[model samples]
Target chain A: MFQWSKDHLLLLWLRLAASVCAAILLLVAGFVLLEAFEALRDIGPVRFAADASWHPASEADQGLYNLVPMLSATLFATLGAVLLAGPLGIASALFCQFYAPAWVAQLQRRIIGLLSGIPSVVYGFWGLVVLVPLIRLQAPPGPSLLAGILILAIMIVPTVALIAESSLAAVPEAYLLGANALGISRVGIIFRVAIPAARSGLLTAVILGAGRAIGETMAILMVCGNVVAVPESVFAPVRTLTANIALEMAYAMGDHRSALFVTGVVLLVMVVGLVAVTASFATETTHAESTHG
Target chain B: MARGMVQTSGVSPMTRQPRQRHARWLDGTVRAVVGLCVAAVVGVFCWIVGDLLLVGVPELSWGFLVEAPIDSGRSGGIAPILVSTLAILAVCLGVSLPLGTSAALLLSELAATDVRLVRVVRRSLDVLAGVPSIVFGLFGNAFFCVALGLGFSILSGGLTLACMVLPILIRATEEGLRSVPSDYRHAAAALGITRTRTIWKVLLPAALPGLVVGLVLGIGRAVAETAALIFTSGYVARIPTSLLDSGRSLSLHIYDLSMNVAGGEPKAYASALVLLMLLLGLISMALSISDRWLSRRMVHT
Candidate 1:
């Protein structure tokens, strides 16, 4: 009876621990929302939509908190990164799956893993020193949206490649063999059969890559020139929502600080939405596999 | 075209030769393109690491790791920053390990009868994992630094990192726990072992490699973090005497040196190299642990 009671107590404790952790996770979102309420109420949703630049007032009266430019910059950078990395990453996975020798594939996987583990700040620093200067020779004042995109693309390639490789691996050998038996060429089978089968997984990879790119702060903050304008071209300097928050949160006060939280709210919504979409895709993949199996 | 020829009808030997030749060309071209993509990724990796080595290696010395900064990090070693980074990592792991393990246990061990609870926990963890680190920074600042009144201290930073890394640790550790064979649990039950004893002695030992991998990955994320810590832990470069004191992280130091300070490039490079080497060591450690675990399992079976 004592042992039973002790085991019950242990279970109770575990339950309490789990519940507390879950509540804390919920509180993080709630806290951000609660804090952003001040800015959202004061700034008004209409004002955020209005065509104005980000000039947070030091005093009480004169601030324009338009998030459009930063919001657009965030989208543009993420889009550019996904566009650049998606094909390259998928291709690398394909090469590993089909073309590379066993040792070479292992090496490639290890290298990609190492690339992912390199700190974002280091990537940012490298971009600032090397790529920024190289861009400057072509276009003066090289810290532009292009720089951010390139850096983010590099940062996210591993995410895409690793996921894509696993998904490609999940394509059953029987399917490939069936295609081979049909006298389909290897390249034709890959393009037609394997890729089509792994479509949802590939989409999940791209979406997750976009999620990483969109939320990225330090690297984009370092390379994106911190200009408060919508990018007219890839070469144009721009600031992202993340960069805006990081650049100002250090010194911001009152409404300005609340505005940063508002930025956080926007970022949280974007990420959560991406997560939801990925979850749906994951379910769909599993469902399809279940039905087929 | 070759596929078309193969599918449609039997072809004459003369025509089949041309078609086979065309198929070979197509395969070769596709192979070259895919290989080029792989080469590009590897080449970029080489470029980044080689660049760091060329510029940063020259700056590395014994003094670089053990002295305080001078002139706002223009010239000096990173002893204080190193101490602070390790301190923050310690606090982060210290807080996260218990919470993450318990939460993982709830998922892997205790929640089997409650599918709804498992689904809810899994979904929330997925969402939490996707939340941006900058959002985490803001939350830490607002909740820990401001509301909790921890201020810009290592305690606040570490707690914030704990929150950010919890989902990762829980997921990884849960995977580890799940990988343990159920036969062990049955065996323990046959021996009349308590549930806790089975978990502690039989399950957790089997999951140690996964748990260690997860811990190392969490440490890597916390160590590499800059934006999240910038507001929570703060930018004070002194060696902290307590958790309440503000301290600079190595990543933050490198960021400030390269971006904020002029003529701080050399030290920044050196700091980056050190950080890179540390991360490399952690990665290899994870690899070796998993490798050894796999070998042992193979031998045992």
Candidate 2:
């Protein structure tokens, strides 16, 4: 009885802590909603969302809060980053899994670990000095959409590669042996059998990388030009939703401040949407794996 | 029998050599492509670090570490900024570790892993992990600083960071606990040990390295953050005497120095160098310690 009671007490204590962790996310969402309510009440959701011009600097009554410009920039930059990173990340994973000598693979893995460990601010600083200037010489107004995409691509490559590599490693050795027995070449086996088998895991890697690219702030803030206009080309300056929030939060007051909170709500919604997609892919792969096992 | 099989196939040795040569050429080409990708990563790292050191090393001096900002950070030191960063880190780690470990233990040992409640908890953690730091900054401003009446202080910033890093900590700790062998539990039970004692005495020690890895990662996130801290901590440059006092972090100091203050670019570079060194130190220390611990555990087991 005493043992059972002690066990029960411990379980209760742990359950409380677990609930605390869970409660935090709810609270964050709740607080954001409560704060965003002021802006929604003042400007109906449709008009606020439909309008593309976001000139919040005007007098409070004359303000306009369309988010399409920044939203498109965010999507554009993330998509570009993902497009660049996805192939390289998957290719690197294949190299590590199949082609590289053991020591070379270890060295690459360590470098990747160090890369991911470096802070985003450091990357931003580097981009501000090096990448921005390189872009400036090639195209005027150097802090352009291309710079943001490139920096984000570099930042996410390690993450995507690491995840993809792990998934590739999880591919059963028996499959490789079966391919070998059929006289398939090493490269042929890797492309035809291994990659196809891990396709869902590879997709998960890309989705997670996309999430990182979208959520990224400091690095993009330094190089994305912070302009509110829609970007016409890769060399055009634009602002992301995240960059906008960071750039203007200091002096914004009353409804202007509340509008930024609404922007936060939008960012939250986008990220949650991405997470939902990632979760579905993750579960689907796991379910398939379990049934195969 | 193998020789007879080759003879039966009736392929000349001359044809076989060409096939072998073709296979070798393919191998070399594939290896070269992969090698190029690895080189690109190395090149980027070297370029960033090399450029920073060339520009930043001359500006770093003993005076820079000890002195307070003068002339809007065009000259003087980052003493207060360093202190405030440590204070925030302390608060963040203090709040996160115990709660995260407890939650991980609950999930690994007590709860059924595939249950609805467990699934809900894990899913929410994933969503929390995916939320942008900027959004967290807004939420922290609204909830921690304004509504909770903490009022733009280190306490508020730390609390916000704590929430931001909780998902990572929980995931890491849960993985650690799950990795421990089930035989330890069975053996403890056979010895008439209570479930609580078994976890404290056996499971935790075995899971220590994994937990440490999580701790290191959480520390990294807390240290690197700027936007979230700006709202919650309010960016006061002086050292805080109390938890409620506002503080400036190293990342924010670099941002302000470079962008807001005039003639502050050199100082920003110098501080960026310092931040880089600190992160490198943390990562190296974590890697070495975990490696040693794992090796030692292997020898013992």
Candidate 3:
């Protein structure tokens, strides 16, 4: 009886420990909402839709807190990163899985792992030193949306390639063998049979990559010129919502502080949405796999 | 006559030769293209590492690691920053290890009985993992610093890091536990072993590689973090007297030097090289440990 009771106590301890996860989620959401409440109430949510500039001030009447430019910059940068990294990631995954010899495959895997492990700040530093100068030769001002996109693409290529490679690996050997027996060319089999089989996984990889690109802060902040205006072209300098909060939160007060929280709220919502979508896709992939099996 | 007619039909070898050649050409082109993509990725990796080594290595010396910075981090060494970084890492891992392991146990062991609870916890982890680090910085600032009255100190910074790393640690450890073969559990039960003993003796040891990998990865993330640390940790460069004292992290130092301070590039590069080398050492250690463990398991099985 005592042993059983001790086991129960241990289980209870584990349960309490596990509740920290839920507590953290609630605490983060609650605090963000509570802090952002002032801004949301005063700004009326319509201000975010207003295409005006973001000029936060301590005084109530003087400040104009519109997030349009930053929001659009964030979206445009993420889109550019996805477009650039997606094909390259998928193609690299294919090569690693299908075409590479054993040593090459092993080396590629190690490289991808190391690439992902590199700190974001390092990437930002490299961009600031090397990439910015390279771009400045072509465009006078170096730090621009193009710089941010290129850095972000490099940062997320590992994520996309890792997931893509796994999904490609999960494609059943039977499908490949059957396609080969049917006299289809190697490339035809890969494109028509293997890729189609791993379509949902590829989609998941891209979406997750997009999520990472969107949330990334330091690397982009260093590269993307933090000029709070709508970018005219890839070369035009721009600021993202994340960079805005990081730059101003140090000294913000009163309404200005609340505005930053509101920015956080918006970011939290977007990230949560992406997580939900990725979860749904994950379930769909599992369901498909179960049915296939 | 019939044989001659069949040979001249629509699917004859005369027409098939061209299509076969076309398919082969397409195959060759794709092979070359994907190979080039792979080469490009590897080349980028090499370039980044090479650049850092070439520039950062020359600045390294024994004095650089042991002395305190002299002029707003333009010269001198990173001793104080190193101490603070280690202290924060200590606090973070000290809090996260037990909590993360227990959480994984709940998910992996007790999951059979509490389906809804498991799902809720899992979803929360997913959301938390996806939340941006800058947002976490804001949350940490509000909750730990302002509300909890920890202020901008190592305690708050470490706690914030703990929260940020929990999801990764839990998921990785849970995966490790799940991958342990069920036969061990059945055999333990058959031998009349208690549940606690089975967990402590059989399960955790088997899952050590996963736990190690998770810990190393968490360390990597925590060490690399700049945005999340800046607000909670503050930018005080002094060696922290206690957990309540504010201190500077290496990543933050690197950032401030490069961006805010003029003529601080060389110091910044040196600091970055130190950080990079530290991370590389941890990763290689983890790889070797996991490799040895895995090989031992294979041999025994």
Write model 3 residue lDDT over A120-157, tens digit each, in one string.
Answer: 88889999999999999999699999999999999999
For candidate 3, the docking band is: medium
Cα RMSD (angstroms) for every candidate in the order listed: 3.2, 3.9, 5.0
lDDT of 1 by residue, B146-262 (tens): 999999999999999999889888988998898888898888888888887888899999898889988988888889998899999999999899999999999999999998999
A-chain TM-score, model 1: 0.96
lDDT of each residue in B1-301, candidate 3, tens digit only: 0000111123555667887778768989998999888888889989988999999999999999899998999999999999999998999999999999999988998898877778888889988988889888999999999999999999888999999999989988998898788898888888877778788999999898889988998998899988888899999988899999998999989888889889999999999899988887776766666667777878877
Model 3: pairs clashing at backbone N, Cα or C within 3 Å: none
Question: In model 3, what is the error at residue B77, expressed in angstroms?
Answer: 0.8
Per-candidate DockQ values are 0.55, 0.51, 0.51
Residue pairs whose backbone atoms clash in candidate 1: none
- Looking at model 1 chain A, report the run of 10 residues with the lowest lDDT sum: A51-60
Q: Sum up the clashes in candidate 3.
A: 0
Largest lDDT belongs to which candidate? 1
Candidate 1 residue-wise lDDT, A79-113, digit = tens: 99999999889998987888777778878888888
Give candidate 2's error at residue A280 in angstroms: 1.4
